[model samples]
Target: MNNNKSISVQNLTKKFGNFTAVNAISFEVEKGEIFGFLGANGAGKTTAMKMLIGISKPTSGEAKVAGFDVYKDTEKIKKNIGYMSQKFALYDDLTVRENARFYGGIYGLSKKQIKKKTNEFITELGIADIADNLVGSLPLGWKQKLAFSVSLIHEPKVVFLDEPTGGVDPITRRQFWEMIYKQADNGTTIFVTTHYMDEAEYCDRVSIMVEGKIEALDTPENLRKQYGVDSMNAVFLKLARG
Candidate 1:
């Protein structure tokens, strides 16, 4: 195992009955690297992520996430990773502080640690005034940012984001990416999936999945040059269309 590699996979595959959601695919994600996993609907990105996250087992092949085997050390992997999905995973009725405490507890933090971290996060996010407010009352961008923060309460080695910027405005998306960059700078590997081509450009390296196979994996600049395109949108369109 390479200490610098946060994620490593070889011939990883997942199937449902006779349907193969993720074909034999192999890739590696370096520590602190922002890796964009891209594909259109039904492109198997979710399935592969599930395998890496240890929620779904692969049909064959080997994978290691945060230095733990996906099949054998799922519990350890879970402890070392955070996940933010498309939907806001916080409880709507819970106050911002409450939600933070809840997630912190799930990560097995002590009450003292939870309280301390929650206070720091609220202050850092400039939500100290509204820490007692219900999460549902917050703006979409605030909620998204808060959700991301909560996911990191345990200081996980890696964070997986699935279409995290789906419905927000451009400014919100930019702000969210800033948070991602900060996390990566702090040594947290970011594995993200997004439909927005612009978001793909922010990654250190991106992998484009088509028909359950990775067709391209490289830096955004390199991918653009390889595909003879000016933008990631164009590159994605060309690959996805075929």
Candidate 2:
């Protein structure tokens, strides 16, 4: 009940007609925590995330994000959270500067604030020479980084990332994670869904979903040790198979 927790859910469920997409589930994430959400394809992780982010109403549950109730304060939840998806990072046709300006404005930044942040982004991302160039022209790695920075334009209390590093190289993913660690260090709660086992190990804690239910929730080291496995991947496989 304390507001210090970034996310809290109780018996959250979502159903499409007679079929339940996300079974009743509950969890809590502390402020500044990196919570890894893991599941196989169609395991209901996305469905549950939708409810937590206030995108989809839960069938029956009580949930809160950033201290705002998901049912009564859906709009408030949206304002306090940043979201980034691997599928669509940014508009390719828009220039890097334009994309930043657009997202900053969408977040309700004043013209002056947008200008200042846009210039900061240019300098920080080292895109000063190509600030006017189309975002499509940048490398995939740069685009992902830019997308991430833009998501934080409003300094959200929490961020939700869906497979943020799908096709990037190991070096780029490492760099992206460094950025993640920095944000968490600054007291931003990060709720991320990733298929990469190595990334899962970086989380303060991880919840693994199976068949619309949470099969395991614990630290990576604990999960491995509890299951008598050497790696998170092995723990996942052992749980998923059972």
- In candidate 2 the C-alpha lDDT for residue 141 amounts to 91
Worst 10 residues of 1 by lDDT: 119-128
Candidate number of the best lDDT? 1
Q: Which pairs of residues clash in candidate 2, taking residues 3 or more apart in a chain or in different chains?
A: none
- The local lDDT score (0 to 100) that residue 28 gets in candidate 1 is 97
Total clashing pairs in model 2: 0
lDDT of each: 0.95, 0.91
User: Each candidate's TM vs. the true structure?
Assistant: 0.99, 0.97
lDDT of 2 by residue, 10-119 (tens): 98999999989899899999999999999988999899998988889999988999999999999899999999986867899999878888988888999888888788
Which candidate number has the best TM-score?
1
TM-score of 1: 0.99
C-alpha RMSD for every candidate: 0.7, 1.1
Model 1 ranges off by over 4 Å: none
